[model samples]
Structure formats: C-alpha cells, structure tokens
Target: MAGSNFVSEIFLFPLSGKIAPILAMATEIKAEPAMVLAGVLLSLVAIYIASKAGGEFFNWLGFPPVLGELVGGVVIGISALNLVIFPENGVDSSASIIVKMLELTAGLAPDAAEVTFQAQSEVLEVLAEIGVIILLFEIGLESNIKDLMQVGVQSLVVATVGVTLPFVAGTAGMMGIFHVSAVPAIFAGAALTATSIGITSRVLTEINRLNTKEGQIILGAAVIDDVMGIIILAVVASLAKTGEVDIINAVYLIVSASVFLVGAVLLGRFFNDTFIFFAEKFKTRGRAVIPALTIALFMSYVGAAIHLEAILGAFAAGLVLDNLHETEVGRELEKLILPISDVLVPIFFVTVGAKTNLGVLNPAVPANREGLVIAIFLIVVAIVGKVACGFSVFGLGNVNRLAIGVGMVPRGEVGLVFAAVGSASGALSPALDVAIILMVIITTFLAPPLLRVVFGEGEPEAEEVPETSG
Candidate 1:
C-alpha cells in the first residue's frame, strides 16, 4: 500500500499546476465543440504513437511488439509521465482535466466540470474495452476453427496436459504456498494458462517445421489453449463481478460460454452460403466488407448479451469465417479487419499497461517487494508449467521436447487479454494486475531465443500455405 500510495503522489502534485490552467483557459474559450474533438484526437494519436514506438523498440530487441507497447503505455501513462488521462492519486487526472476543459469552454465552476469529466471517462473506458474485444476478434480470425481438427490426438493430449498442468500449478502455488485468497489466486492461475498462437506459429513457420509433427502439436495445442483460456476467462469474469466465485455461477458461465461458442460457429457455418450469396450481391467495392464485419459485431454483441465477454463472441465469429481465406469475401474482410486490429489492439495493450502504478515497485517502499516476489513466483510457474507440457507430446516423430515447451511459453496477446478482463471485472487488484503483466513480459521475451536454440536459425523453404496462428 505504501508503494502504491507513493507512486500516486508522484504525478498528482505536478498535475495540479500543469493541467489546471489549460482547463481554465479552455473553459474561457468560445469554441467548446472544436476543443473537445481536438482534445480527444490528440489523446488518441498520442496513445497510438507511444504504443508503436514501444512495440518497435521491443521488436528490435527480439521480443514481441505487443510486449513493448504495454511497456510504452505504462511509461506514458498518468502514473509515470501523466501521458494517459487518469492518474492514480485521483487528484488532477481525467475528471479534473475534463473539469478544466468544460470550465474554460462552458464557464462552469469546478464542481460542474468535475461531474461532466466523470461521465466522459466512462465512455473512454468503453472504447478501451472495445479495443481489446477487436483484438481477440482478429486473433480468433488468425487461429480459426479448422485448426482444431488438423492435428489429432497427440496434439489434444499435449493441449490438455499443457492447459491442465499450468492452471493447477498456478492455482495451487498461489493459494497453498503463498496463502493467497482463492478468487485472485484463480485469476492468477488463469493468466498462466494461455499460449500465444500467433507468436508460436510464426516461430515454427520461420523454422520450416510447421508441417512437422511437433509443429502441428504445438500449433494445435496453442489453439486449444486459447479456447480453454477464454472459457476460464468467462468463469473468472463472473466471479470478479461478484467479488468471489460460486460453484453454480462458475458452472453456468462455463456451460453458457461453451454453448454460445459452439452455437455461433455452427450457425455461421450453416448459413455460410447465404452470407456469401448476400455478399456476392453487393456491387460496390466500398461496402463489400460490411457483411463479414457485421457478423463479427453481431456475434460479439450476442456474447455480451449472454454475460460472456465480447471477445468470446468475437473469437467464435472468426472461427465461423475460417474458410473465408480463399474467397473474395474473405480477402475483402481481411483487408477491413487487419487495419482495424492494427490500430485498435495497441490501445488495449497500452490501457493494460496504464493500469500499473509503478509505485509498488519502488525499493523505498516495502510493499513493492511483495509484488515483485509474487511476480517472480508467477513467472517461474509460467515457465515450468508450460515446459512440463513437452513431456505430454507422445507418439510424435522427431519432436523437439524443448522446442514445443518453449513455444508454449509466451503468453503475449492472450495473456494481456486475460489480464485486461480480469482487471475490468475486479478479479485483479492493482498489484496483481502488475504482477500478471510482468510475468507476460518476462516469458514473452524469454521464449524466442530458447526456441531458436531448439530449431536452429536459418531460412527454410517458404510454406506453401501459411499455417493459421493456431
């Protein structure tokens, strides 16, 4: 708590002077509408650019770009550089910034400005939420539904063992060994269970082992990991909202999420011809991608309508369109979705990064030590837990146990998605959120080099057909 408190005050004091005058001046301005739009646009640009810079820097270092984006977001966030809207101390953050803007433009007193600011922040939060949903949506599109069928029993065994071991180990380690409470512990465990299909598959593709037995197992297991992780997320989200997990509630979420996922995919497949027919009728190139985008949004909304995360619905939507890859409609849809994903997904990651209040990491404050220790503990579990999955890859030809194990290690986007929803639903406290992100950061960076060792680095023949991120 001390470290958390210390961090909050760092930016709070500077904000009082720097931001208040801008608000007051903006309040005095006659052009209120233009200013608000300008303010929002400026904020959006800053977020994207900062995120990109961080992502690229990390990429150059041989780590995943998303990892850098998260780190960049934290650096520019209100906690550190006051780059984002909200500050930890709750002094001169979003609400107050809004208050000043309104006061200058609307000529209201401090109180009125503050109230209006609160309302605006809720909208920004929703935007940030949607960003992540779209992210998972794109990830789902990359992994797709057909991946589940290609690899067979060996992959299933690897996936099942891979998923189960990490989860149990994470849960048990937190609750039994660390004396943590169950709800948070469950979430902490859930975070450890995800594997980054996009990153893993890309590595395998690079090594030209994608068609190999071990490669199939790794990719298939990663896909299974994503699906299982999403269901677990739904369960944890329900508990986060209620401040605890209940057996009946958990059961309902699991069943409902499972049913919705299967139903969405099946319904989409059954109607795929109709969708293509409707899509084909369109003459305007400008509007061609709408049908696919519409289905994605519709599915996402339905998932939320049933109390599951919109991401689950989005994932299913992608699965339904899995075969669209070879069609004109698929090409058009990809053109539309990839840009949207590229723009919005970084916002989601940065927001997750912004959630960290680095005060907890300050050495002067003893409480930060707890966060650091827990993070280290979780990182160890994330590695060992995934490494253990290599043992389950039975009946495979020339399997690199180390390679499969290393491939499963990076949590990447999926881990961040889990962390975001958990934080949003109140499953993770601020400290725990930072801890999860730290684990993601470490494992994401560690996985690539270790994988290179197992596969050996050199260009291989280009894949005839790129494997799905799965």
Candidate 2:
C-alpha cells in the first residue's frame, strides 16, 4: 500500500508540471495577434496625421510639403519622442495579443519571435518603396510630353552635365576624403546623381514659370535624369550583390530596360489611338477611364518585370496619353491619383526619418568625426558639381544658366532612395547613412528658395536656349 501511494504521487507531480507549461503557452497565444494588428494600424494612422500636419507647417513656412513631411517624420522618430515603438519579449498587452494570435492561427509561437519581427519590418519597407514608385508615376501622368519634347535638347544637356559632374565629384570626394574603396565611392557618387524633380517643379510652379521654355526644359530634363539615375542604381546594386560586374548581365539589363521603355511608348501610342477610335465607335459612358488605368497598370507591371523602375513605365504611359485631345481621362486620372500621392508619398519620406538615427551625430562617438567631415566634403562636391553643369548652357541662347544649375541641385527622393538602398545592403556605415540623409534634406530644403531668388518670381517666360552655337 505505501509503494503504490508513492508511485501515484510521482505520476501526479509530472502531470502538474506539464499542465503549467500548457497554461503559460495558452496565455501567450491569446495575447500576441491583436497586438501586431493594433500596432500596424496605429503606426499607419500616426504616420498619416504627422504627414498632413507637416505639410501644413511647411506651407506656412513657404517651403514644399515634403519639407514638412520629412521634419515631422524625424521628430516622431527621435528617441526623445519615443513615438515609434518596436515590440520586444516583454508581456506587454499589445505585443502579447499579436503573438498569441499568430501562435494560434499559424503555430508561430514564442519560438517564432524573430520571424514575426522580420516580417513586420519587411511589410513596412515594402510599403515605403511602393509609395516612392507611385509618387514618380503620378509625376509622369501629369507631365505634358509635347511641351517636354520641345525643351528636350537643352534639358538633355543640363541633365547630362548635372548627372555627370556629381557622379565624378562625389566619387572623387569619397575616395580622397574617406579613403573608402572604389565600390563604395562609386556607390556614393551614384547616390548624388539623383535630382528631386518634385521639389524643382514645385519651385518652378510657385514662381509662375511652369509654362515657360526654361521651366519645360527643367521639367523634361529632370525626368530624364531620374531614368538615368535608376539605371545606374540598378547596375551598382547588381555589382554589389554579385561582387563581379558582369558586362553581359549589365548589357542585358540595359537592353531589357531600353526595350521595355520603347515598348511602353509604342504600346501607349497604339492604345491611345485604339481608345480614341473605340470611344468614337461605341460612345462609351466611362470613355478612357478604364483604358487609361489599365494602361497605367500594364506599363507599370512591364517596367517591374524588366527590372526597370515602374516610374519609367508611368512616364512613358503619360508621354503617350498626354497628347490625347478633348479627352477627360487625363484630368480624371490626375484627380484620382492626387490623394494617393499625397498620402503615400509622405509615408515614404517619413519612413526615411524613421530609419534615420540622429544619435549618430553625437560628438561622443569617435566615428562621428569621420562622418561629419565626409558629409561636408560630399555636400560641397554635390553643390559645385551641379553648379558646373551651368557651363554646359553657356553658349545656349539666353538661358538662365544659374537657374538651370539650381534646378539640378536638390537630391530629393532620389537621394533618399539611394541612401535607403545602401543601408539595406549593409554597404554604408551608420554614420555614413545619417550623413546621406542630411544631404538629401539640406539639398532639398535649400534648392527651392535659392532657385526662386536666381530665376526671379512670377513667370516671365524664358526663351529656349540652344545647346550649342548656331
């Protein structure tokens, strides 16, 4: 009887221990999923409000909306504010709910903590990237291709010179000042090659110069510059990934991109004609709405598939359809996309702020000295390199050479894209990353007012200047 009772107690003890673990897991499972959903929704709403508030603040300051958006993001992301929080292992109600739901539905419990974190990060990153792509696309949709073509030659010269000087200067500066490797130096140069068209356009429009020859040329060249910048970025990214710059692969990328660009243009032309013909034939109610959106999506998809920036596809689509006379489709499309652009684009810029860790600027860190010096040198190179591009317009007929140079100044979204990519690829140090972010903000903020002063306010239409002497 005594032996039997001892055996029974031992069995009961084992059962009790197992039950406790099960209860603990059940508690965790109940809490985590709700937390994740709530976090995402809250973050997004907070971002939107911040973006809107930022725009209003910047507008009052006589700056572009982007300036406010960026500042707002930075403010929120600063460690002092503690506004943006990431989840950790603490049994906080919010995080616990998310973990619990994930565990119950997907069997991803405590062991899957890292996986869940990574997935959330990825979703945020992708959303930001898509915002950028769509912003560029909207720009394309609004541009007038016919007017753009008339200004093409001078714009081409400006863009080429603008891109080239920066590329060379930035590369040289990185190599000489930082003593970094050729690959990193080249990447740095590539990052500086991007011109922020949105900022330039806004300044031009504000000055009432949007319809002028110089304005048109600046706009056109900015678009071309974006295309060239993307190609360079792709090549560099490929090199970074493989460590071997395969000429064949590079050429393939170039060819594929070119083909997609050309194909988009041709397809857009064909579709425009077909749509006009069908609209006349069938007297359709929606007219070009369905067709235009369809074309936009198709061109965007094609560009993505070819490893080209979807913005290029959007630009191409715009160029083709911009000539559609007497159609409400163009105007309608613009209206539809404006809200999306306003919302998503700010998110992209804000994400830039979130990723930036200004603590790197602390003088307490020894590495910051290197970052500061490099940043100052790069900023000088960035400014002077593009300023030199004005010389390309020296012989051109009555062009505001200084204005053209200023138009090329702001690195804008393009610079941000480069910095983001570098950070993601682990190609940039933390300090270097922070420096690049500052470069984007400074250049963007300074360009508009400077250009306004140089070009004169209130649109007295500048004449088209030839690229060379007649």
TM-score leader: 2
**Cα lDDT, all candidates:** 0.66, 0.65
Q: Write candidate 2's Cα lDDT for 1-470 as tens digits.
A: 43233323322333353344435655444335544464455567767777888878877877666667766776665433434433221122234333344456656556644444433444555577667666656555555656665566777888898888888988887888678887777878888888977667656755666556667777777877877886677667655655655455456556776677566665666767776676455555555555665666677777765556666666677666765645665555556666666666777777666545566566687878777777777787788877677667644476677777778889976787787667656677766766776677678767876777777645444353323322
In terms of lDDT, the poorest run of 10 residues in model 1 is 2-11
lDDT of 1 by residue, 1-470 (tens): 43223223321333344445446755653224443454455456667887889878977876556567767877766467655555332445333443455456656555444333433344455667677667656655555455444555767677778778878988899899878888889999999999877556655644556655566667767756766776676566656656544455445546776688668767766656777778888888644457766777888888766555566677677777767778787778777887777777677667656655555556565655676788988999999988888877776455577777888998876786677666655667666776887788678657756776776655244422236563
Error of 2 at 429 (Å): 5.1
Off by over 4 Å in 2: 1-37, 78-126, 198-211, 237-244, 276-290, 394-396, 420-434, 461-470
- TM-score for predicted model 2 compared with the true structure: 0.76
RMSD in Å for all candidates:
8.4, 12.9
